[model samples]
Target: MSTADDLKKLRLKAQIGITTVLGLVSIYILLTQPDNSSLQKWAIGTLGIIVGYWLK
Candidate 1:
């Protein structure tokens, strides 16, 4: 494969890894502290950004 392909794959992997880790963190926080609306909103917002970047 080309260098471009490798770079693309690396970017995709990074994005997926970030999304997974953040998602897990959010789940833990939600389970442990359900009243923290700010953190939850932040998590959702970051995920939205990631999703938007992924879509773009």
Candidate 2:
């Protein structure tokens, strides 16, 4: 209804979209790799979490 409300809605939509995309990408990456390589994926996932937090 108002400008602030509109901006908040947009931000929420963007966050949801980005989170969904990230989840899919992570799943794809993990599935494509070997079991032995999971540790590396966990490390990268940790770093991604940290970076994503900082970004927010």
Reference-based TM-score of each model: 0.65, 0.62
Task: Give the candidate number with the greatest lDDT.
Answer: 1
Quick one: RMSD of model 2? 4.6
lDDT accuracy of residue 41 in candidate 1: 73
| Predictions: Cα RMSD each | 2.8, 4.6
**Candidate 1: regions farther than 4 A off:** 44-56
User: Compared with the true structure, what per-residue lDDT tens digits does model 2 show for residues 14-56?
Assistant: 8777777776666676767777687547746855885686597
lDDT of 1 by residue, 1-56 (tens): 56998999999899789888887887676667667589877766766876787788
Could you tell me how far off, in angstroms, the CA of residue 23 lies in candidate 1 after the best superposition?
A: 0.5
Report the CA-based lDDT of candidate 2 relative to the real structure: 0.72
Q: Which stretches of candidate 2 lie over 4 Å from their true place?
A: 36-56
- Model 1 TM-score, all chains together: 0.65
